[model samples]
Target: MTSRALVVLFKELREALRDKRALSLLALFVVMYPAIIGFTLNRIIDKAGSPEREGIQLTVVGSEYAPTLMAQLKQKNVIVTPHAPLDEQATTDLLRTAKTVAVLKIDAKFVENYAAMRPARVELWYDSAIDNGRKIDEVENVLREYTSRIAQARLLAHGVSPVTLVPVTVQKYDTGTSASRSAMIIGAMLGSFFIPAFIFCLSTAVDTTAGERERRSLEVLMAQPVSPAQLVFGKLGAATVLSAVGLTLELVIAHAILKWLPLEEIGLSWRLTTADLTFAILASLPLCLFAAAFEIALAMNAKSFKEAQSTLSFAILVPMLPLILIPMLDLQTATWMYAVPVLSNMTLLRELSKGADIGLLHYTLTAAGSLVVALLCYAFAAVRMKSEKYVLAV
Candidate 1:
């Protein structure tokens, strides 16, 4: 808080700004992550909206033998293409291109078997690796319906009730709303957006602590009138500022992309208003502080910049644990979840996206949880810097 601390703060900021690699990395992540998230969601929308607009691309061999089946497929929105008989290898190659959903191969004995009231075989050929599973499933559904209809007609012709074959009928209904479903999917990604908070501050945190010591100048700075707490606070402020600004810009760009995307087509939503988004970014600043403070605490122990960077590299994975694990574990949102650092931010953002009514308690916990931990880390770094052993080593 002293003028000397302010001087130290401005001085560190200037040095960080001069580091071209750090600035470039900051810019790269600011743009790169949002673009990737948008691209992924856009692809999901396209895939989800495909059936009604594009229909299935099915290649049929020996189509003349089954006119009724071809008509039925057309009615079900299948684009049937007549083709010559293909060997197994040819079918495999065709499926590999992803041009066709599947090849419908009518058995040579189909007509003979049908005329004799026997079961006729029809094979659906497709590559299991292809991403068009929905299209293949559609084709199979139509085949099942066609078979059912033939059996029904045969039963009627023989003076038997068709309803006798179907003892029970099952129907499906989805209870989950689109917003709820999308929250889970988007929640996993929200943590990744904030990871840059730690990354953006790494260079400054390492350079200010371990790097200064390695350059034999940290002792000179400590010789000044500034208290150890003030010195750590100044350096912490510099790193936190850089991290917060980069993370804010990254979130802004991501917000624009997510709002611009048609997430509804994929049963997803990003319904964050400008006010909600502003609050989310503001609430996330303490997380940046936590990241910078955590980095500084670790970097303080390292003997050199390289050592600090390598050590902090492993520390980066720590924040990622909750982000990766919680979603996989399908942990329910508890009040206690709002008190866990990175997970709290994700839960808060997810609720905001879903337009949930967040109380002041959740917001307070989200900000306070990280801020408290940040202060603890700051206290540790300050105490470590003031220790006799560290001074003797320097």
Candidate 2:
């Protein structure tokens, strides 16, 4: 059994190495994917790290706290403009005209409440229609942080310890290692990008293999004394190796770019160790196997080359759905997250990026499960190929 598998693997590798199309595709990924990922990552970091001010004009209505707040805003490089009648109606009008990016309305009892050490209320009015909800959230966060600091200072001046008000400092202790955190972030980002590529590659690869079978060349090869299972395994193995090579190149280039990108300037370290790279490869292996197996089955079942391509393209939609939704919701990697097949790989990648240690159980289970699925997919394809109807349908 071992010898047969080895022979099959070797044949597939040699065949893949000699195939012009396969070589070109692998070379393309080696050159393009890393450049694309590196450029994209650099752009993202640049946007976030930019120190340029937006020059947003903030209009303050009826605030007794206007003087202090305005000074603070100026210090933060925001232009403050005092507007008349700090009422809701005037504030609304200002926001509508874009005369003010933000409007601040301090309650009438702001001075009284501060003197009494009571909780004071403040209102910020902004156009929610512009630039999504993020700008509003940013303004609110700034206000909250500023207000909290002032309240804490006042309490401290009154002989009250700030720790007395909030005694317990909540610290999150994770059982997982640093690799896990890094994997979680890196996995998600890379998965979003690579899974789609894997799915697409599978479609193309299957069209090259099983689609050829539908065209009769596959049968010509199978009849040459090799078993159908061996033939199918060979094709799958070829696809896996091509995928791995492309992915490896992308990893190497991305790592080199990250090493010199000065990520620490933006409060991040994009460094990855040898162990981290191994974990990333391991995490990706299952997805690659699944892609190959699934694509082979789809292409085998397809009536034409076009049909195989379409089906494989549609299969990508499933993985892309999570890729889109996960980051929007800002979901973090957790124990349960590591069990969700493709999602687990993505989460693991992200955690690996942040230098977190992935748990052995999680790693082992993900790889094992994917391998099992891949094997089952191959077996199913083999069984279906034995059917005269299935073989002749294409």
Candidate 3:
């Protein structure tokens, strides 16, 4: 940028600094997002580290009829609380109280059915919407094992081999490492870190271009000796500077929180070093630049602040779609992934956190892609400003 552009940059930045409301919103998001991410991971650690899962508390009716089954559940760390017979509505009501994970009702004729060699039904009632899936699964496993053992014993008494019921057994294996598994959980949220790159710059970008035009000050500003390039660069620079700083601070705070967290409790890891984090912050500057330039390109064209804000609000979602949808698609990470804007930054950070041995090529592609897009947007805005029709209209 020329010296003229530098003056314009400082002028806009000074004006922005005086806007306390915009600054406050920026500050709030900078701290708020990292704190939220930290709190979520901490909760996960607490849940995973708890032993016995608080004994998978179970409410059982007719417990006396299946003492052996109760013993089996207890052995598997299920705390059995005996209760009177509950009808369907009562059982549903009890489950809704969240006092226990599930209600197990042993059939009243269990003893009679067992003696007659007939099937005995055991009801396991649980609320599927509740967040006790693991406990429910444990209860079901124990019941299955208990039933299988009884069947095996009955077969032995009839002089039939227990193996006769089995045709073949298949063994399964999981190839996913701890890093990949951890990524599966954290990757869902990784996009949020880069999203601020777009958001923090929105106010400054929109206010400077469209706002000035709405106030009817733009024509006078355009009448100045400064070239159109200088004006465009200056405004774009101010927004980019704020966005870059905000994004960098957010990344550092998030990194500290993730590093402090006991993610290992849930088989997760934050494998990023301070040096790696620094590299990521530096590499992500282009995303901030891209965000500012993209908004400025659109906001410069709009006639008023509200028009700019409304149009940019919808237009911005076009770029962010990749950030929200790519993880859901679960596509394998490839070379081309580094060529996208928001996605590239997130992918780079996620890969780094997984301790992936990143090369310069990845960082180059990540930064270079954003830089190219940013330059294109910048060029377009400059061209728009320099247009003969635009000056005449103003």
Using lDDT, give the best candidate's number: 1
Model 3 is weakest, by summed lDDT over 10 consecutive residues, at: 45-54
Candidate 1 — which pairs collide?
Answer: none
Q: Which ten residues in a row are the worst by lDDT in model 1?
A: 385-394
Q: Write candidate 3's Cα lDDT for 51-121 as tens digits.
A: 36577889999999999999999999999999999999999999999999999998999999989999998
Ordered from best to worst lDDT, the candidate numbers read 1, 3, 2
Per-residue lDDT of model 1, residues 90-126, tens digit only:
9899889988899999988899999999988888899
Q: Which is the winner by TM-score between candidate 2 and candidate 3? A: 3
Model 2, residue 234: C-alpha shift (Å): 1.3
Regions of candidate 3 where Cα sits further than 4 Å from its true position: 42-53, 155-167, 216-225, 324-330, 388-393
The true-structure Cα RMSD of candidate 1 reads 2.2
Q: What is the TM-score of each candidate against the true structure?
A: 0.92, 0.63, 0.89
Indicate the TM-score of model 1.
0.92
RMSD of 2: 6.5
lDDT for model 2, please: 0.67
